[model samples]
Target: MGRQSPFLLQIGVFILFFILQAATMRDRIIGGREAKPHSRPYMASIQFKGKNICGGALVNRIWVMSAAHCFDNLRPESMQVVLGAHSVTAQEPSQQNFTVQASISHPNYNMETLENDIHLLKLNKAALVNDFVRKISLPKQGEDVTPRRKCIIAGWGDTTDFETHPKALMETNTEVVSRASCNSSWTGSISQHMVCATSPDNVKRGFCSGDSGAPLVCMNRAVGVVSFSSFRCANPRFPDVYTRVSEFISWMEDVMRSF
Candidate 1:
């Protein structure tokens, strides 16, 4: 259910079959369920004008992390970040909102292959951190873990294809798979910059359309940034792809410190 970014996707099959995928409407969760309010405090709802556009996270008081595609060609002045929120459309008393001052996506971001699909949003002012508005810890640079580890992904994206997305945040448990396994399943579709995760037994428990740029949290650390699911969401063999967060730690530190 991943849409082609305005940027080019260099893969041949993606280019040849891109039109077919584009015709489908953005989809969402299949077997994932509702999440508790404020449970994922660092969660940030990236909005354009007044509508939710993507999921992001507060890495620090004034910096947000999300997929570059979500912000590509979008004006920062028209964007906002909503923290401490469970519902995408609702405004809550406990939530803190901030106007985006600016944003920068990875220099090498490729829409075609979804390589380096990360970005950072700078908030005009530091958010007032509180019980429900704290930042999530990031993984150490170059961190590595064996596959089959369990992780959780949360978002306000759809719960099923063609259905209205839930107002409340939805979450699902997914397992990390080895790159070799992922590559074999997609056959040249997996990129080095991407990490893979999915549900076992073909259960409909995976990220879907509108779930892009969401956080993939493991062991209380932000391990990956939701990149995109393949042509379909929650498919048994085609796991969801993510921008590995650990690999970008150096870039993130440099970006935050520079600006």
Candidate 2:
């Protein structure tokens, strides 16, 4: 067909390249750096069959908090929690692995919509509090993080869509996006139960797959739990979503106290 118009062919090639680049960057730890070894003492690698599948935070001596979706169609007995780990592959002396005693997902949690995504795991035994292992404090009941407030999220998730999960923990700075702005961005899909954060200046940074349940630490308190993000992990158009920890403070306390 007349050699298919060289100009049109060039445009098609450019479009294809752009699409491929976007896909490659999706679900990645773009713009993040390796976390200081053992700096996030409360970070937990929620593993299934010895492979880290999600990130969690040690909330108390025996209670680890994560996303309920991380346990969907999964058994608590098959799960293991690794605390004080800098690298998931390394047999660090500070690491302490625990078998899950019970997995308590919010009763109202919806698997389809991922609402009430927060979850708690009870360890078979209490974790020893030491220099390398400790618990992070939870946010106060009804406490809300304001827009532009600085925060951090760390995980061992993939650095790119096609890459394997990172051996070492990685983290990046984030800023809370206003509920209104976030909701608008997501076409009102963001509920009051969720909080949104993104990198400053529209940079690519935030959680990706396998980072589910990672804590969003603000002011040294876990204010949110990683719930979901855009298909492009670092997409500036959509912010990362987390289950607002403050919204479920009562439920969490009740569960922890009961078990």
Candidate closest to the true structure, highest lDDT: 2
Per-model C-alpha RMSD: 7.3, 4.0
For model 1, give the RMSD to the true fold.
7.3
| TM-score for each predicted model, relative to the true structure | 0.89, 0.89
Stretches off by above 4 angstroms in model 2 are 1-28
Off by over 4 Å in 1: 1-27
Tens digits of per-residue lDDT for model 2, 107-207: 99998787899999999999999988999999888888999999998988787666656769999999999989998888988888999999988877777
Model 1 pairs in collision? 8-112, 9-112, 29-158, 29-159
The local distance difference test score of model 1 is 0.83
- Give the Å error, residue 194, model 1: 1.2
Error of 1 at 79 (Å): 0.8
- What C-alpha lDDT values do all the predictions have? 0.83, 0.86
